[model samples]
Target: MPPLPAFNPSTECPPPGRFPLTWDEIESELVKADDFAESSTRSGLLEELRVHFALVEMATGAVGRLWLAGSFVSGKLDPEDIDVTYLIPSDAYVRAMADPDTVDNLDNLGTKDWCVRQGLRVDAYVLRLAATEDFRALGVTGAMAPDDHKVFESLGVYDEVWQRCRSGPNGIPRGTRRGYVEVVL
Candidate 1:
């Protein structure tokens, strides 16, 4: 949470089988949240992910985005398995094969293998530009909405904490308001 330990791009090493990312590369594309908490602990975790996504994007050459999704974003980090979604272009699989050093596809097996090599727990999915039934079911509408970007831009841990710590028993959070965290590229 302590301002995420001043991300030093030079010092960051990519997870196993992944390439390293430079601080400048990530800083150039990094997005800042309008609302950030004073707690360094929470902030550090977020920053770590920012770097991670930057690397993912760099390695894949596919537009990538990260969201606080899952229990952590919903202010329920106690569960330990923080759900995160990494949106990669559908062509990422092809790209991986072409550039083995930077990208590697393990089939439709979600990017968990990659994440595991890096010591992170994640649920990654490749999103295609084409509008398919699966895409529709996932609620992706070709491009990101203004509000959607705003939500990511203004993301913070406040709401999740409030909903969990303040909600009474049997008042579990539900709906799009509580179940998901979205990140787009």
Candidate 2:
């Protein structure tokens, strides 16, 4: 993975796309880089996210990669929360959705609503991948049905959507693009 870029002065966030980082790098860059009042807050949030990630994976068994966005990934001194977008395997999604036990965890991880309800500062979203393999080389294979080709298209849609965010760090809708951090679990 490449080194993360500095935050934009205006958006207080990095440029748009996925910036993959190792577990240690994530802790170092996002948490320890800033020596401020919010350092402890960031540390706590990281731990909370670890537990949440494990719980989600145990329930659905679909988490392949995790992208961090929102204020926590920004230059904010004291962000209220961390935003997570779970990149999951398509087959795992089917299995989890079909399984009866995943309902509660899946339902609770629906969006940012769980943040307020649980008295935590973590938000989540889901983006399913066509396969757990190289996505760049992926396309409509002859073995796939015509309708199923849309799955590949959906990946692009999710990429675009996740790449876009408010231009400002205060959550105002200024329509700016910012990259997210993919934390290695």
Candidate 3:
């Protein structure tokens, strides 16, 4: 795999592209990129990400893919929260939705508002399951279901949105954009 790229100076963001990494690698690399003063804050934010991941897996049985976006993935110092996108397979989504016990977890895992209410410093979103570069571990095969089309569409939107800079306090992007990293499970 290629090394993680440096932040684009102008936007203070990661260069526009996909960087697939592991949890260990994300901690070792992404965190180390921040200044010394930001170390503790970065660690705490990473912990929140771990908690968010566990919640997603508990609710869905599997996270088809995990994506890291927003300021947390950028070169910025002391980002308030980490933005995460969990791509959940349809089968897992159905199971999670059908279970009353997992509803709150699903709800928390699905939206940014619910996550804030739960006191999780994670801006979360769940999209139609996406295929990783290597799908073997994820149990996705060569076969493409009709719904895969929607998954592609969903991913495209994420790519487009995440690639842009959060222009103002409201996060309405006004043209400027950046890149994000994907967690390799």
Candidate 4:
């Protein structure tokens, strides 16, 4: 497999300090894996999750709950992207929007752009707490499915799977736009 690209969070115009694991950082974390065990993915996922969650906490000043609601948690290894949901309180939205820095940081453009800039094939979404029930249901159903290979089909899961089973336009959106940060790959 080819190496993943690096990501730099800093911008010349507004100058947001670099965030979380850069491409080098992610690679180092992945390289430390003993033999691509489940735990290895879990560790790498956790690292990425922490970085994403920290950005939310720092930008919103509100600590929200995070749930792994996509292929990563559903036993799918060939995930095209990471999927997660941030349960942010409704009350915090206004405050977050009032602050330009927070709003700017919350934009998918910044996150996506950062990943592309780093050469990493990653995409992220932010979903509000209120929108998670459906996602949670989808995740649970996928997890309980009998066939690991068929789990994606069982719940109509896609985005991070092998090409043969990739979903079409009906596939779930890469990320939800309402939450603070719903998905990251």
Candidate lDDT scores, in order, read: 0.40, 0.74, 0.77, 0.42
List, residue by residue over 1-185, the lDDT tens digit for candidate 1.
11222322221211112122243332222223222233333444455566566666666676544434333443222323344445555466347547756534423224666665765455554332221224234355545433444334333332342223223353533321332333433
lDDT rank, highest first? 3, 2, 4, 1
TM-score of 3: 0.81
TM-score of each: 0.41, 0.81, 0.81, 0.44
**lDDT tens digits by residue: candidate 3, 47-136:** 888988998887789887788988788766777899888888777877777888787767756687777677778988877564334545
> Residue 171 CA error for candidate 2 (Å)?
11
Model 2 ranges with Cα > 4 A deviation: 35-40, 132-141, 145-148, 167-175
Model 1: residue 139 alpha-carbon error in angstroms: 18
- Candidate 4, residue 70: the lDDT equals 38
Q: In candidate 1, how many Å is residue 145 off?
A: 23
Tens digits of per-residue lDDT for model 2, 142-165: 545334466667767766766777
Weakest lDDT window of 10 consecutive positions for candidate 2? 131-140
